[model samples]
Target: MSVTVREVATPEPGRGEVRVRVHGSSVNKGDRLVMMGTPYVMRLALGLRAPKHFGLGQDVAGVVSAVGDGVTRWQVGEAVFGELTLGAAWAEEVVAQADQLARAPKNVPLAEAGSLPVAALTAWQAVVEEGRVEAGDRIVVNGGSGSVGSYVVQLAKARGAHVTAVVRAHHADRAQALGADAIVDAELEDFSATDARYDVCIDVAGSVPMSRGLRAVKQKGTYVVVGGPTDDPWLRPLLRPLGWMLRGAFSSRRVAVFVARPTPERFAELAAWVEAGRITPLFDSRCTLDELPQALAELESGRRRGKVLVEVHHRV
Candidate 1:
């Protein structure tokens, strides 16, 4: 549960890999789960006693400083952004497969692009891939003001779906600005208990019960679970989603437990969306590399409205 900034050897790119001089990275839910080593079942892949990998970040944006053998997709100075599933993005340099990165969006600062990879990809997958959202579809996004939820609201809206954003009282305006057609303040309203139904129910907050989320979806509609309680020391986060998936078999509605799988093509699509002004990355705060622990603490406190960016090589 403790994090420290320490010096490590500069990593070198191997075959078909590229080393990026990282300018920015951001704290993500995965980072927190790994750092805490919770939901004990994850330990099997991480480590039984402690995590095998200590690096704590997934999203990265920077210039490709070096490319290894057989890598021709990038040059020595091309600006790129991507995700590293196992977490190594907190450092000044990171080595990743050439296929893992995509050209950074020209409309945004390269550092700011770091905030887009994981969260944006998750939203894209939820709204487009999983939910199959389309024009005239009524979609409700739980946690509309969150990092992923913010993008979901916009993406769904851009797809011509009517977006209902379920958010905290303080995040109402932000959700509205994100193109949410309706704002259901969680403090004053329980969207699950409402008579209104949606063609797609995207639960990014995981604050509501799974059955209720499923109930909110119309018959034959889709219920996509993007996140859940991560603080549990045992199986809460994992088990909760599994339970939803199991319950789906008996119900008329479709249920999906979403796990983001990022691809270079998807990254390109997100970049295009940003450049076209269809979606924008939201930021709650910024912090230096050395201050990442504090930034992550703020993220875990559930007080942040959007992405918490960490400036690695700030000069970018």
Candidate 2:
């Protein structure tokens, strides 16, 4: 898969949609998957040979430049941020359905706000909704240094859960700053081999065996798969979770896999968290519209920490 920036006709908003002058957009796992057209299993919905959509950013923050008919919640020039289920967010401007966006966090810059959307929502749902993490619960967040992992750590801490952040050794201090009660070096320690039993195990790294993750959970505990396997993707990324679910069905453990559902209301909830200072997005680097290809290449390298933000159009 290759990326090339091409100038296309600037799109106009349709019914219930708004045209946004994108000030900041961020690269994410979904962008990489869409660009590669991998896990061919998803092609049924994405595309067969190539992506069904041309553009490739999912999280966007910008100003509403135009609003279509029947739209009342937003006005032209309102700053907003949200996720686009369809790719097309990588451009200078993008058209987003009015229902899928919320006002950008007033407490932070639009570049930081652009880093939320998918990762924040995914972490919230996994930690609060599916995992049922609560006060005094012992929770282990596997892969605690990434975009989603960092959020999981903070959200879990806000809920008063005792969090153990499992990550690479060098990121130990970073995870601790995110409120980890304990840090486990995945490079040197096998989390499953530890004596620590957690009430909830969030496997975002997806590097370890599913059985190992399941074993990390305490008896009658929950195991949530928020990311995919690290194996080369043809179908492994899609199939590993299914296999885990099937295994879970026959056991007493409560295991579930989910994809984050984006909505305006969800973004509003995240915005509130931001305003309260409970959530802070982490950034690994910054890029511009013309550097999208290079940014994506860095993302593909798996060396990035936190989110890689793309500056699309600077709003005054």
Worst 10 residues of 2 by lDDT: 297-306
- Our tally of clashes for model 2 stands at 0
For each candidate, the alpha-carbon lDDT, in order, equals 0.89, 0.86
| Collision count for each candidate, in order | 0, 0
- Candidate 1 on 110-220: residue-level lDDT in tens? 889999999999999999999999999999999988788899999999999999999999899999988899999998989999899999999999988765777799999
Give the clashing pairs for model 1.
none
Cα deviation of 140 in candidate 2 (Å)? 0.2
Worst 10 residues of 1 by lDDT: 297-306
Q: 1-316 in candidate 2: lDDT tens per residue?
A: 6799888988899999999998887877777777877677778888886677677889989999999999999999899999998868888889999999999999988877888888889999999899999999999999988889989999999889999999998889989999899999998999988788899999888886866677788889999999986446687887888988897897778997888898888889999999999989777788888887876776677565457888875435
